[model samples]
Target: MANAKLNVLVAEVPEVIPLVQEAWRAHFALTFCTSLAEAETLLNKRFDVIVCGTHFAESKMFDLLRMAKSKPKSQAVPFLCIRVLDGELDGTAFQGISIATCALGAAGFVDLNRWRREYGFDQAREKLRQLVVSLAHQPT
Candidate 1:
């Protein structure tokens, strides 16, 4: 476990891919999924952690999180919700969503915009990386 590479399922929109790549790729092996169907297919495969975005067209983050947590193969995997302030949602909305996701059994939530505004880009990136890494290493 100490030397093993973390496997992350990143369910995000196309726009957020670069952000995930920048902050996550260096720390984990990531699989990107844009829709519920894509995520449904990938859920069968083993993943140490799931980092999901809130921009899917048909399904919400809660839907995706529940789907992953329901699957026998992925039920034990940690799920983290990533919220990007892309005008679709504001800061207050994101705070509510963050609390909601956590209540639904998510391992954590990352508000990229808030972190960047408060801590700056480099620090926010490291903060996210550290949170995900810590969640991935937790006991199942």
Candidate 2:
């Protein structure tokens, strides 16, 4: 299905729905789930990429990440974890979370506060585009 758009599942809070839709709808088929449980259920289906909010970190997000890594259909899929900060994102906090998720095998991360404040979501959009292209190029 080379002509079909990639599928991306975003497990994030309601506040960020519009932003995510704006950034990824044009390039991929977007599915939005507001909670970790919902995301876990959706995982039974196929998605080329999974984007999770920091709020999910305390929930089942990590379990889902592990599932993706182990499942044959999603073993090579990439996951991006985005964090929404209370105020300006502290460098240390950002690093800590990034390191944690990466250690758990996330493919990448995006700081929502940074994306909105500094880049108007351009960086986030680019990161997603990169994932889409990279996945497309991989041998099935």
Name the best candidate (by lDDT). Answer: 1
lDDT of 1 at 130: 88
The 10 consecutive residues of candidate 1 with the worst lDDT sum are 82-91
After the best TM-score superposition of candidate 1, give how far the Cα of residue 98 lies from its true spot, in angstroms: 2.1
Cα lDDT computed for each candidate against the true fold? 0.83, 0.73
In candidate 1, which residue pairs clash?
none
Task: Give the candidate number with the greatest TM-score.
Answer: 1
Residue 2: error of model 2 in Å? Answer: 3.4
Native-structure RMSD, model 2: 2.9
lDDT of 2: 0.73
Estimated TM-score for each candidate: 0.88, 0.75
lDDT of 1 at 134: 87
